[model samples]
Target: MSEPLVKEYSNGEVTIVWKPDLCIHSGICLRGLPKVFNLKQRPWVQPEKANSDQIVALVRECPSKALSVKGVRFKEKDNSDVKVTLIPGGPILIKGGATVTERNHKQVHRETVAFCRCKRSRKFPYCDGTHAQPKED
Candidate 1:
């Protein structure tokens, strides 16, 4: 497969880093703050439309590592502990210094993994944000 596309949108204070290949299209960013993530608009992301703090919070909730915030970092914490968050109708985000291995001990992402719970993701095991796509009407 080809390399994933990484896009960046900025409000000067903060930039939203988007990785389309890793995205599960959960729509959390758009739903949480439409002004910044309106799909109807050109470029789709308007980081200037919202405050950096709000944008950062929403991006952290992205199941896939697709949406991430730049220009912000928290004080060092004990990240040796693993963390997981399940989206309402999407993937499960497993993060924080994790070493994921398959049954044969083949390694996957060392720190983060987004597992598809919806079973419709073309990307399989990893989420491609397919859950966010509107079903055919």
Candidate 2:
């Protein structure tokens, strides 16, 4: 297996782990906390801008589960109620946690996941933010 491309940003108390490959670029992080998740910034993520608790709370809302804190696992509940959100031109986000079975027969647990609807994703079933890119004629 290939190593995933990941970046880490720390603010002493908490460290944010970013998995770009897993990100659907829904902009939830950027929109929710621009002070820390500015795209125009050099490193992109500046965890120092917000308190650790605030960052953690926002990261937990990431539908793609791309943004997470080190040593922290997503808290799961027994609620079977799931909610799906369709992002205008992006991936379909499914929240409320579920067990996703991959084509390889691997069962992965996730609090949220993004599925590609545009069919342009190189990641196949999963959205990798390809729908947001310009189409080539």
Candidate 3:
């Protein structure tokens, strides 16, 4: 079988593992804790950003299972195929081949997909460039 695409990190407080394949790039990690999850840097996970408790809580909030924590004895896998893009004021753009199912009985076999996070897309689940609108702040 192929190798897993996950990475692990720890700072004596706790150990965190990241699975890029399952990541939806919600920006929760970076937004919640920029000190630890810096996308601008390579390897992108700084165990020192926050304590294990805080990190665990934030990781759990991820809509996707991109972030996970467990005992220190677990091993991290390699994540080379996972591509995470940070869209400005928009949902994350994931690039890969996966099965997507909708409530309208439509199944799309696509290589790329963009999810909306700004919550202003007229296309519902898909992004329709609604994030370009100004927010009330």
User: Which one wins on lDDT?
Assistant: 2
Residue-by-residue lDDT tens digits, candidate 3, 9-80:
887878788888898876778877889899887768888768877887777767777787875332344545
Clashing residue pairs in candidate 1 are 24-128, 24-129, 25-129
lDDT of each: 0.82, 0.91, 0.76
Colliding pairs, model 2: none
Q: What tens-digit string does per-residue lDDT give for candidate 2 at 1-137?
A: 99999999999999999999999977779988999999899899999999999999999989998999999998865566888899998888999887886877688998999999999999978999889899989
By TM-score, the better pick of 1 and 3 is 1
Please report how far candidate 1 places residue 35 from its true position, in Å: 0.9
Tens digits of per-residue lDDT, candidate 1, 43-119, equal 99999998988988888777777888775654444565788999899999987756664656576666778889988
RMSD (CA, Å), each prediction: 13.1, 12.0, 13.4
Cα lDDT for residue 133, candidate 3: 77
Model 3 weakest lDDT span, ten residues long: 71-80
Candidate 2 vs candidate 3: the TM-score winner is: 2
Better of 1 and 2 by lDDT: 2
